[model samples]
Target: MRGKLRHGNVPLRGIAIVAILLVIAGAATASATLLFLGEQPSPPQLAAPPPIPAPGPEPDHALRDGQPGEVGLNPAPIAAAQGQLAAGTQPSPGHPHPSYAGEVSLLARDGVVVSRQATGFALRYADAQGPELPAEQQEKTQNDTIFDLASLTKLFTSIAVLQLADDGRVNLNAPVADYVPEFAASGKQKITVQELLTHTSGLQAKIELWRLPPPARLPAVLSATPQNPPGAVYRYSDLNMITLGVLVERMSGRPLDAVVHDRITAPLGMTDTGYRPPRDKLHRIAATEFETDPPRGLVRGEVQDENAWSLGGVAGHAGIFSTADDLAVLGQALLDGGTYRNQRILRPETVRAMLTNYNTAFPRNAHGLGFELDQPWYMAGLSGPHTAGHTGFTGTSLVIDPGSRSIVVLLTNAVHPSRTWGSIGPARLEIAQGMALALGPPGHDG
Candidate 1:
């Protein structure tokens, strides 16, 4: 039984191929039979799926029972974001986003790209050598250029867990300890895999992995205990994907990076997305905001999440690098129910499961397994019950709207020199709004 996409009543399809052949005992016998009776021939039977229906109003909004409607980014909110973009210009009294070299923002709606603009690049801070990016290095900041997605790495981690569920190697409702025995050390023994995916695992939000001496970190994780009663509340915990990473490694018997690369990145042809980007590709890499607490002046060609860095830059929570183009493919794949270019990565039902909002009682952190559902302040006007996407603290986000059959990806080095400046919420939300405005709302009745 195949389930249709819950967001919209998108149809499901199946594909099968068959070939038929007949053998003759001998050439002489065949010739003799041909002279008498024509070779035995039977009409080959074949089957084909129905043609795709023209998209109309989505037929279903799959949810547990009563998932709330998501907020949408309106023209007003979008105008406000653009206002913020303008202020991100020459540092003025109110502008928070310092003009520390930004990317060109592009708004795409429907199948059309509506708006594109370059901003926040002229201003700069001293580099490790206290030198600014020369004019040549600045070319990659254009609209066509790609920005590295930071901790948004969790999106891939979530996909991996769903893949395991599809393979029947793991069950979302089952306790995660079924695979990673060490994860059961604390009271988390009874926590279901779904709980972790939804950030309701009761695990500590973070352990300051970078602060601990290298040898003590793993021990720290093994000894982690729940901060709240499991499944009783919602708490965004990096520990969730961290555990998932361990589970993926244990089940696949390969490092998380290898498993993700082979299953998610490589098959999708996301050539620009991977863990620890190669040195050859580093030249085009955008510089993240500098940091001094860890004694690292400016972070480039390195993982940004401290926990991921502590884990040697391949944690399930945050050790992948990707660009807008590569991740846009990922977004499109999700929109297509996991297949792109004739390669089926995820079944329609599985994709449905990922987008279903499981957090009903916990309202603030609305989420599904690896995907965040309907949050308007960050989602801007794009929030809807069927809307789903995720954000990385490193100025990266992916938003998919089943109703529009559209996706928006924004990548920036918002934290170019420090995490202190301000939230890049406007930038992320503006990109989605630009796309929405470009696409325009559907229907003529209004």
Candidate 2:
């Protein structure tokens, strides 16, 4: 009787378990359909994270000498650039080319000097013919070697004019005659101060000032006629800066050099940059050109521009001599919006005006009040509307890219043997491109 009861209960229990399993399967299918149709259950909530803090300001505005990696620059590119400068000294037989005899290049990113190199000989020189010289006679270049700034002197003159404008001593829009009455002699009364700064003043590109007697050069420049109507064309003229230099002297009742020293260089602490470097510093000066016709042999320790040389090595357009380090300070000041080491050389608004494009009429020849703007030939990848720079005939160049707050100073004695040697423009662009590539992507908006 017990065995029969157990068998009957087993079938009843199995049927009840099967019914329970069917209910669970139906419920699971319903859940799967809901999940597949994008109807999943909600998850538990948690608090969101706090916001990130804003970055602080940089420590200083002055360029602090540091390693490339310290400023987030790649050292390889910079080293490669230095290697190129070193190779430039050697002559390749089949492909003989003109290159720097000596170069002092400095690259700065956000006011931190990442690379500073001096290569080749400051005086590995030759006479006007530039034949290779004995090594014993050569003077190796140093970081502090003084270089003739050449046409880069225009930047100083431009800054001085803008400084005077800031002081309310002159007006940018005023006619040139307003400051210098004699400047009106050659139908130039219509030319404005702005036109001279922008190189659209229509003045003749240059006069053989060296040909004229010392007393007559100034008069000739002042009385010279325009090549075209004022602002009607764009032609770079040394006479424009020369005339402005004279205007600076007349308006300030002081020499142009004195005004620049007392106003710009002194305030910026640029001790090695000025007109007529002292005789004591002559040992560190780079040799430039050997002019047989002019009887200047192994030109060194003096201004290289003929017009400036004729003017006693003190002119508005060309005359200033500077070291790579000294120029780095000036470049930093301009990149810092006219202030460096707590000294303000120009008002912020004035700096903005200086870097603003005043030459929309001459698109290819973009210019600021005292700087060249967006020049790809020299500025390279750093070229932009706000980029500023100047090139000197003596193979010196300064490029400041406001976009990156980066500065490149490439000083070469390309004119050492002779100005006839081809241009260093390609090398100039290379140095700037190396810096731009090293900085690479400008990591932050700050």
C-alpha displacement of 39 in model 2, angstroms?
A: 72
- Which model scores highest in TM-score? 2
- Which runs of model 1 end up more than 4 angstroms from their true locations? 1-90, 96-100, 104-123, 127-140, 143-146, 441-446
Q: TM-score for every candidate vs. truth? A: 0.76, 0.85
Across 336-357, the per-residue lDDT of candidate 1 in tens digits comes to: 7777666667766567656655
Q: How many backbone overlaps does candidate 2 show? A: 0
Mark the regions of model 2 whose C-alpha exceeds 4 Å error after superposition: 1-60, 93-98, 441-446
lDDT of 1: 0.62
Per-residue error for 351 in candidate 2, Å, reads 0.8
lDDT of 2: 0.76
> How far off is residue 334 in model 1, in Å?
0.6
